[model samples]
Target: MTDYVSTTPGLYPLPDWAKDDLSDLKGHQKHDLISGDESEEITAAYEEAREEVIGVQQDADLDRIVEGQLRWDDMLAHPLAVHDAVETRGIVRYYDNNNFYREPVVQDDLGFSGDVANELEAAAELLEADDDLQAVLPGPYSLADLATDEQYGDEAEFLGAIADFLEGEVDAFPEHETLFLLEPSLVESAPEDGLDERASEAIDQVAGATDADVVVQPYWGALEEKVYAHLLDADIDAVGFDFVAEQDDNLYNIQEYGATDDVSLGLADGQNTLVEDPEAIRDRVEWVYDQLPVAEFETVYLTTNTETFYLPSGKFEAKLEILAEAAALAEVKAA
Candidate 1:
């Protein structure tokens, strides 16, 4: 099996060049650039920024680098490449004004758009060119969470369509050992009444669609086994557990679920500036290693739970430095 390590959770800060372009666009109040005809100046700026990030990864000696998610706004924007990927009319309120939610729109019959497919192909090419890096695509459950309610009538149908779309995208990128990191951020907000059943059904529908190894990541809190039992049974390759949130300690129950599959130890805090102690993180990894073989340790990817911290560029870079340091320490200790 191929081994991997994430630079950190969320995105790396946009390099100076990218920032300059963004500032220029903002100065002109050009919010529509991302969707409209590509500006030569803007495209050049994006390339310089991307090259700088890729160069940083090479310099760091990091084995697997992320495209740094410089392209997509966030996981929600992943499917935006598709024509009318979402319906603007029916929107769901997110946790706060900063985060709004929408559902994915599926036509009367299941259909995939060439625009989305082409965009994904282009994204794959961008990541593939950088031989040192691997790519991560948003998982189906998270995509469903962001879609508008009017899109699917029922969540299952919406999620199933997402699954089918993702399956094709994964197939399209056949050469790379890509990790389809499923971010189920909305699972935490399920109505108190039937949260478990709803979460399970969503996970099952999406997990069932992909052939590539899937990693189910529940970022905000501990994942109740009952809620993720379908993922476990669906033969998911790994489960990413966040250890930074309020109830992170609850992840200890993961041991009871079984250590046979990959367990991504999400120890780095993506939201805070507090640098994590490498020794402390190593201790956590060691605990898991004790239960599983060192060879299996490669399956333990370290990352943050969410990417909310990425909006402001400066903070993002600080987090990246911390992650690089922590990853280095983990490698030394593991060695």
Candidate 2:
């Protein structure tokens, strides 16, 4: 028997009004860098949006809930970008997509400042049980690969340093059921000849940081055989595969390398505007489950192939609704 879970892997889509408020806030920051001007209206708007998103997840009857990551202005680079030891460099295209983010430029040794931990805690306050919360963060490899490193000149050394920085962040994290490490860079820019092990070591560093179950997901496409093989060696509880962009490679890797007790199936197309039928999503889950080498799965998560931040809020909502319904169907069949 396999347990089923449902969650969005990255920043949930923001309401149109919240986006306007955020844009205005950014304009204010750009106009006057010295002023520590905080917008109460924007804060209120964020709080409202957060509450609404939580309500949506609850309405969908999801097994696990993410804080929606609505506070993320820089996506993966926000925590590092806001740190005193780092600076925001020019924008970089995000993984061949129509999106962009300000890359974090690390100038000194980094430490956790509870940036995301605070966000997670806020979500915790609204939930009935603390155990239902799940947190999402950029995996160590993606953060280091996407950023501009000024301090550590060595490649491997910088890789390990990012791991240590993330460890510090999760070391300060509040109690939760799971943590999702988004590592789209692994699929977009595959590791070199011998660096796969180093990347895995870096990932395992953060995986060992907290008590929560860790899931490292690579999206934007499927991973190569060697990359997938090395990733399975990591100490994390599960590895998620993108079934939307590149399904065959992902399916092949699972068949050849086997899988952990738990696995994440990215059945929804996050970037697309169309919403999948709930039955279709459920069928895909069962199909993937049947291909698993193991007799039973400890857990199988229903997720988007990648982040849904680019999709419209209405469509994103519909997708989650579909995802939850699909998960319900899968659970019933598994039972």
After best superposition, candidate 2 residue 296: deviation in angstroms?
A: 2.0
CA lDDT of every candidate: 0.54, 0.83
Model 2 residue 61 lDDT? 72
Best-performing candidate as measured by lDDT: 2
Q: Can you write out model 1's per-residue Cα lDDT over 157-247, one digit (the tens) per residue? A: 6666666766665555534343546565534554233544554555555555545455666677765655554446655677776766734
**Candidate 2: global Cα-lDDT?**
0.83
- Predicted model with the maximum TM-score: 2
Worst 10 residues of 2 by lDDT: 29-38
Residue 225 of model 1, lDDT score = 55
User: Candidate 2: lDDT of 21?
Assistant: 73
lDDT of 1 at 166: 63
